[model samples]
Target chain A: MSIILDHVNYTYSSGTAYEIQALKDINIQIEDGQFIGIIGHTGSGKSTLIQHMNGLVKATSGAIYFNGQDIYDEDFDLRNLRTKVGLVFQYPEHQLFETTIFDDVSFGPKNQGLTKDEAGLRAFEALKMVGLDESLYYQSPFDLSGGQKRRVAIAGVLAMRPEMIILDEPTAGLDPKGRDEILDLISKMHDEKNITIVLVSHSMEDVAKYVQRIIVMNDGSVMFDDCPSEVFKHYKELEAAGLAAPQVTYLMHELKERGIDVDTEATTVEEAKRSILKALC
Target chain B: MLRDITLGQYYPADSVIHKLDPRVKLVGTLVYIVSLFLFKGPVGFLVITAFLALSIKLSKVPFLYMVKGLKAIMILMIITALFNLFLTPGETPIFTLGPLKMYPEGVKTAIFMLIRLSYLIVGTSVMTLTTTPNQLTDGLEKGLMPLSVIGVPVHAIAMMMSIALRFIPILIEETDLIMKAQMARGADFETGGIIKKAKNMVPLLVPLFVSAFRRADDLAMAMEARCYTGGKGRTKMKPLKYSGNDARAYLLTFVFLAVVIVLRIYNL
Candidate 1:
């Protein structure tokens, strides 16, 4: 029910002349059914940290416990772990290779050793859950628009029925409307299925709107871990680390600084709007 | 982290060999490889080995680093040695191993072959280690200029070579990302027979091919936007010229080749 990283340290190409330490002594606990947002600048070890959850990349020096199982153990079933902790990468649409959208989404379920019928049904349900139209099911994934292709890619992961799903910059390179659509879909999944969601993103506003908890990473270390409102309070530090709080957080802080009595902790626009109106009235 | 792979194996150092014009190094390498085949007897081999050792010393690259290149061809060396040991017709018999007769001549030829192969690999490695890929391509373009008279499209060929060299690392990084993405979708790459393993590669290769073509298209457009024509009337930023060191290198190489040829003719 929990994934815990205990003092993990990862060094790339340890013995070579090009050796580098990508992650440094990181520790974080992610509980069941919680929507968490991980925010970090480029090369802040966010991607490396997420890869550890599914055991895709083993830590050079520490242990990762997924559901109380030491994943580093020699006999551990990594393939099963991957099924349960599905990951969607940045530009996920580039991964679609099957001739039809249905077959592409079914690839994940089929790999779980399901019968063809069962896999097909699961794929259908998953595609529906992602809000894709039935008319596009039989078309080549290459023919789909950018956002639609991404939805199919997500459906592929959804078919696995993972307990926890991690997405790395799922909305990157999309238009504002497309970004909101993807985030809303993810939020709905977190609410309806009670699935653990680890959304790794660089957009503070998106994280503030949908995520309950936030983890800020800086230079391969966890800089802050708390509820979104509390994490946004350290706006100055975040800015110094090449990141910034949500726009609303900054707005609220500016209002307070201008001698207006206001709550500066509101992380989202809706919350900030309510607090400012309440103080004015 | 996957991007840390070192490409082209160019080791930066300050030395006489490193400072010589790359065209000279290219020609020297050709002469060196040709000399190895020209020498047939032990005297010729000794003379060549001494010359190779001196060249390696002047290159300022570690001897062990050059030897490391031989590891890649170890299997080929062993297989060829085995064939020569068993297949050659000989007069004097040493022993027989499971129906394959062994002879002194066979053993001698086998040992000589292993030595030749090892030297060949080490010799080529010395050239690659000292010269950067840019320098190598530049040397190739200039050295092949004479071939352009016979309509070889030398400049276009050089441009293609340089572009391909640049994209190899980018393509490798792209492949790594695609493989990881597929792994997240429950694609197993670690298990299976040869056929299954290749089948597993489809998930990787498709995306890689797509991205590579996209990159090539973008590069072509970029070059067109910048008005890059063929190498006609083009000027070099740092044109190559021969120095005293290069002249001396040529003299030493020719002298060594002559010694090997003389010894070979006399059967020393």
Candidate 2:
């Protein structure tokens, strides 16, 4: 396992008037090379839980272990731990401070004490990994469009080359084309690099199409943890938890409820189309 | 790191101070601060302190919150007092320490200055704790309307202040998010020397500045779309007017100021 959270509990603004229990008793194991999607409504503790994997947030009561070592141990080097488990926050371009794109992407590896030449090579490689052109590396990051800026921010993290990458709502606020482009880049990173990918998203369609496994959270608790198809099968429960099944699954379910002979378990449009054609035949 | 800011935080309560019109509260605060400078002797200080305590009680604001606010400025307060104690000359010296002499006049001046500053801070804090930022801006614009005859843009200035106050918490939240995002990328801010820590701010500051500009541009466009053009011929939905209660409150403050001025001249 690359990351394991053991009965974790996290509270925001603890001991203040605004104290809120964000996560409660969250226990899960994320294996290396697994593509996992975390689905939840707003403020369901998905962001808080992912922040724990890299020691950004210490558990209020329990523990988090990374690669079989307790990350919160006194002797643990938390900086090294962060480099190993990269986290890209939502709308991460807001953290961009460097004058040029190349310098921004090289920030992580340089901080890790990599030699200039090595860090440059890593930054170049990371930018290419996200489909940014080499010619634009020297241009100011402020010149980039919204989608390109997002990619540059991700490359800033990818330059460190972590074993696991956790992204919180990475595709948020992007148009559909931009969202798909970023999603495809993430999928390629997971497949080609064999990296553990934990994607936090609110879109059922995206989770159904890309992720191998899904974890659903509701009101500071894990509602379901299973394969995407299996989790989507509990459509009513998911809906009650403020999440909807993918459109294909929803349409199939509606058809099934209306006396059509179709498999309501279909999670993708292709599968739903095939089932509908079969039912018509 | 920027999450600890408590500015513009109004604690909701149903007390006499909270119920007062914001304009009344604003004028009352100004009068109280002026009285602090006008008062002379321990009797005047004692009277003002008592008034402060009663106002705090009436406002239903926690005493500890005011103490916390004072603690933030304790170092500056102490420096001011120490400077006065060592510098002011008097007829008789109270103490001498390594070429620094503390005179009775210096001690009296320091104590009075400290008490005056403290009371001023607490009185203004009471106004902020009771009035929301929107209400405060409304009161400010109404109070400054007389400046319009001199060609001053009072409404525009008040609008700017109101917007800035509203965005303080939002900017703080954005800064917190940016810090966490950089920290996740291995930026260490806690363990470095001042220079190194400043260098660490590169990643955090770049993004924050960029986002701030973007937000500003977006806000400008949004405001333009709503036809917001510099407050000319603008009418307010809630026009500020003084009621009978406001007149009574202003009268009470005037009497308090008169008493403080009388005590100062008589030295009693």
Q: Which candidate number would show the highest TM-score if scored against the true structure?
A: 2
Q: What is the Å distance of residue A210 in model 1 from its true position?
A: 1.9
Residues B165-248, model 2: lDDT tens digits: 887787888888888888888888788799988987777776777777888899989999999998789898988777787788
Error of 1 at A116 (Å): 0.9
Q: Can you write out model 1's per-residue Cα lDDT over A244-281, one digit (the tens) per residue?
A: 99998888888998987889988877888899999899
> i-RMS, every candidate?
2.1, 1.5
Interface quality of candidate 1 as DockQ: 0.58
Name the lDDT value of residue B145 in candidate 1.
96
Q: Which ten residues in a row have the lowest lDDT in candidate 2 chain B?
A: B1-10
User: Cα lDDT of model 1 overall?
Assistant: 0.89
- Compute the lDDT of residue B41 as modeled in candidate 1: 88
